[model samples]
Target: MAAIVGSTPTFVPPHVVPPARAIKGLALIAGFLRNPLEIVPQDAYEQDYVAFNGLGPRFAWVTGPDLLKTVLLDESDKFSKSVQIEFFGPLLGQGILTSEGADWRWQRQVAAPMFRRQDLLSFVPVFVSATHRLLDRWRRSPAGTPQRIEADMTEVTFDIICATLLPSSDATVGLALEASADRLQRSAMWRQLYVTAHMPKWVPQPGARRIRAAVRALRASVGALLTERRRALSQPDDLIRRLMAAHDPVTGASMNDEQLIDNLLTFYLAGHETTSKALTWTLYLLACSPQWTVALTEEIAEVTGGKPVSSDHIDKLVLTQQVIKECMRLYPPVPTTSRQAIGDVRLGEHLIKAGTSIAIPIYAMHRHQKRWRHPNAFDPTRFSPMNEGDISRYQYMPFGAGPRICIGMAFAMIEITSILATILQQAKLALADVHAPLPVARITLHPKGGMPLRVWVP
Candidate 1:
């Protein structure tokens, strides 16, 4: 897609990480532990592909769709999950996200039906009602007071996930996970550093005790929910219920308590966190770009006729969808991901040897200067249907691309559309602080120091 030909953008949303030259030794460790973005080079944004040999294996980072398709899809088995176990294994165990071969496939198959279009459409009310609950609080309180958008989004999305997936569970479940959320997120940075350096998870690191405590607390919560489900008089129709009934099509195996906790925690943490971060950035972009906000509000008005966001209006809110698409482009939920080659593979002209690590720094790729015109500007029009086809799927992957892409992509988009439509219908948000929050990688992309917005029903 071509750049919007006009005068310079007045507000090019915050992109604080200046492209870094290669950093090394203690500085590299410090930089990586602080934020994974530091390890990425400018070439990642300017070139289709780049490789560096270090950090336990020959490292290849690719931004082009062709090369990405080769690695993420065509040669997927040859390129297995890298370091995911070290980073999230403590929290998720041998869940779908970290498992390989038959284990990952069957687990994915079992959970797949829950995310189908029909099932996801049924979830729109939960999405709308949750947003309304948060908005109702703003309606009751003082007008100009700042609301922590990040925290608000997190809580609302967390509510949505639990309500939709674990419909039978209640306040106790929320209390269990809520207590551990902050500590767990903080621990991720250290985990990433440890995994990248090839250090075992048990290696003494910062926040190690709290991280263990957080993991234990989350697991206990899920375990209780599992027991609660088993003792129920009838099987309620929800994800938990589905998991109980599901058996592996191939192996005929079923999930035990430990496995249930593993998958539940995976969905809980991955599901809520990514969508929350996406909305947080979307609102921030809206606050900075009033024109886009006006555009979205108009679309929401025209489509819903000032009614609450319903499933019918989701597809009709095009501009609302575009703004979210662009926001994700600027600040992708999972900033980067990697895989290791199990066998020799050739991507483009480069021959990847066995054990080579392939990194896909999605944040850089989304804003890659060569791939996107006026790459850093906060313009949503590029995602418009007419222009969107001009872009390649791999070059602009916010939900990721190919087979292992997020299972909840449709769920996220529908939820995002519903929540954005509901909130924009009544609430007006403005940046409370002049300081722009830097987008940082912490399992999911989060605005550093949180996003505080002056939200009011005006």
Candidate 2:
């Protein structure tokens, strides 16, 4: 009965009404218990894009590009990022990702300069080096036999993040940091969903306990690293050092150790998880579509002249970019986004009351029948500049959109492209099994069972 664009407000059905069903308040909890990523039918997108009413009172399910624009752009001020992302507060502290209003703006300002084009360019060698290290590890495996590669791309991406953002000593702390990160990410997913399902945060739930433990471990590790960096006084230009030295423009105060740790943790967590999942999906897609793999191989060969792929050649790998984009379309790492209404607002015809949550199902929107021509098909051409012109901006938001869009967008693209280019150049991969793997959505959408692949020399 909602009024959105391209749809009639009045129902003119001349058929019998569907049977009534009981609403399951505990549906999300059950789903979490099962696999934490099982798609519930209640949460499934229905005709005209209506799904389950969110956990918040009077919340109406919002889907599709038009609704996404309304929430993310048109009525942006009425929506706050804090309400939807409160789950991150406990783990990341009051960092930029979880902050709102002026505080968030200031944090963004200080961090924005660090990810500029020049800084990103300087980090290219770090990416190149990490990729080469990974390839070397792969090469060490016995010859002729397919190497069973079950790498956690999260670990790989985290290694690169550490190398680029901090001093070399940070790499020594990487293994511990990575273990804590994985535990935190997994526990956060479960706890956030549980809390969203109306479970009291104070409850001594197993997931909540794990989340707390993970958060504590992460903070301790980051704190020790920050102390070491401050003491060593090395790598003045690195991100952690920069944050340690940043001054508040308005207040003329610098970030204290706690604030610095919080911001660093936020960046470290976000920087790697999404990009890692993206690379995992990209590799899986490459395995499924060998033609694309062959094409990517040839492109890498021509661009690198059979030499090692470097960040300088990243921009030239257009086909690799397309392949990554197509993979994102199918298995977006950040598959869902939400906002909380600050005042009564009318989205289409649906009256969303104050304090109501507005969920934009990026996963469903990307796969919507009317939105994408071949919604389920793996087509890299969809991202080609010539063909991309026809796609709506809101329809393909892997990193999100509008004023609060992801600040790490450029960094992520660079990492994915560079890592993927290097891998494809030196290796030939095949799916360990013929059956297509289902995505396991935790903090990010990951392939179930680690995307096992048989890797060999190209």
Candidate 3:
């Protein structure tokens, strides 16, 4: 048994132990062919943490509540967000999502005021209206036919984010923004997989070109919006205006055009992708778990009573939130997080050197046997407030933990629940296929073949 820090003994599995070189070699090869990342199962009873390569000298994985606490809470400063995320820097500029250190803190402070609870309350109607539009669009589609639901969800979320975050509503710009987002995601995934294979970032691969083109298009669109917003003296109650008006309180310097564009793009990309994936997965789970779906339907009906799902109403639908939580647990959109060690550190008995790339595999952690009871089962009850006490804090971080946790956590939760409730109010959905598609690890965890479902008027 390997001696690990903390109260309990930490044992490396047989696959990770003897013949370490062989395992590393296998991972390297897989990187060239597919994604270098592998989702591993953690222990069933004690603690669940999955370890994988963090694309640098360090070997990284997620496990045990104590470990999560150390990474997210206790020793957060020891780590920094991976430089690899800078692949998005060109697209997102120095936006909060792609920045670090002082820059991140400054932008976070500026953006924080715009996302206050009161402001979010005002945006509830935007969410409800967008969802209603989506439901209406679905109703017009041919019935009993397999609908590529993922695409629809993507469009719906994109529109909501655009309406709520941007200054203008020109259909042309909206369409371009949506197209750019799609292209950027596809390109980023290609780049991530290629870089893991040890390919250079500047390689003129087809995927690389696509990514560049996507970024260019997105930049042009955002640039136009920024120009318009700046030229017009009067501003609206939206994220764009807030960002434009934001200034570093201490330095009193405002963000440049480039910074504004990047942050705006970041919000659209990060905000939409995660929310859409969560909603899609929630629908899939609801399809497979009819009992839960029916119960959820009853809850939605009783709570809203045919009213649209406002943010206030979203809170009342506890079961809907649980369903979303469970889906996120199983298929967290951002399945892995990485950080580079700023200095040498001790993780238990393991002496990790500075510059090591640490990986926190949320996917593996969610399914680890030691951390979860019946790890493979889809039981929303596990997340119930009453039942959640048994779970470790670090063991179940779907939105991540600590200071570096996702900034848009509350926004995403409200968006997902609101949209899902709106859909339930208008339609009943079923999976078009008998079996769910296998999960694929992209930049985000997505269904390989896309989520196809049959929608019928309720």
Candidate 4:
């Protein structure tokens, strides 16, 4: 195999197996904070299953491709998402991400139509326009100016979300919603990591007051918007409008204001955060691998013919898409997923007891030894047309797999490709710091401090 980009003395963290006696309460969490992949035992890359005993629960982190399929695809019903619901239900309410059983089925059906391929393709103009605006802002900062790229990506995605999902919303409300998502995510992560989930709400914890305030502000703003949209005689064709019209097919029932609010919040949080983080990490990898950036720029030029990229040109920009795919493989936004078994289940030779938390360690799986030729390296060629048939379906799940896969996968791909093409078309970005940004896992994977990249016109 050819030498992949970022294969030099770059910033890939090494996974290590902690000594038997070193595993203790909060130690794993602390280790994970230092390096997200470091917490995974080195043996997990080759092993089918690794049972971990923690202060909270006894869960098995399974890495076998077939075993992963069994959990995420084949036996999804047996492995319910009770554990995820417990972690995210408060912050997200009864949204799709937190709901299960009949409620989950109904929510998925209601939300499915809005993300269809045609509808998602219709969002291209919004994405390209947002990227242009972002570049305009960057141009004003002067050539070679150091900027926190992650925050910029977040701001750009936030704008796109507001334009496409809530066109009627103003800047002030959008800011409130953004702040609410950030606060609630941090608060929820802290609770999941350090504090007990069963702890009473009255028991004061870190960021409790701020979380409360942010949640209240977010609810009030979205509720007010819903009320105003309800009064409008004619509304624009956007997600808010579609959601307002969506009803349960089986029951022929419409969503009440609370359900509407929950779904809206879910879109805002998921859409804005995941897309921005993915872009951030992609740029980080680009900085470390300038050759791939040059290749992507050339591909963009040939596809656009030196003009602004449009929806019709999306398929022609294949290399740029591969770069984004490899970036997600290296640093998936939602790093790990855990599911609780509703009943006893047998995974291969092991018998998983009822209620056991089954962890599908996505990050580990992407880089597992048994999966790819060069799992740890940045190689977009792995996803090229000729190599697509060689890769296993379950081995590359950035957006997850099965019926519960991410609904926004298509939309996210279009958005990422557009934003990346637009950026590479005009400017060449390079890492501004000598050391790499430390990878941190919160609600989403983020660079610990921020990504500062030097932007120069190409």
The prediction achieving the highest lDDT against the true structure is: 1
Better of 1 and 3 by lDDT: 1
Summarize candidate 3's per-residue lDDT along 303-344 as a digit string, tens digits: 887787765786788877877887888778887776666798
Candidate No. with top TM-score: 1
The lDDT values for all models are 0.83, 0.71, 0.71, 0.77
lDDT of 4 at 247: 76
Per-residue accuracy of model 1 over 1-458 as CA lDDT, tens digit each: 11232335556777746445556677777767777877787878888878875455577778888999988888787888857766788889889888888888888988998899877988898999999899988888799789989989998999999888876445888777877877798876776776776776467888788898999999998888888878889887777877877787886878888888899888988898899999999999999877777777887888889888888988887778878998999999989988888899888998889888888899999988888888988877788787889888788888777788999999999999899899999999998979689888887887888899998885
Q: Summarize candidate 2's per-residue lDDT along 225-288 as a digit string, tens digits.
A: 8878767844667778778778878788889878888898888888988898888878877877
The residue-by-residue lDDT of candidate 4 on 350-438, one tens digit each, is 89888777777677788888876667777787777777788787888988888889998988998899888988888778879685776
lDDT of 4 at 24: 50
Clashing pairs in 1: none
Candidate 3, residue 216: lDDT: 91
Candidate 1 weakest lDDT stretch, 10 residues: 1-10
Enumerate residue pairs that collide in model 4: none
Off by over 4 Å in 3: 1-56, 194-206
Q: What's the count of clashing pairs in each model shown?
A: 0, 0, 11, 0
The alpha-carbon deviation from the true structure for residue 216 of candidate 1, after best TM-score superposition, in angstroms, is: 1.1
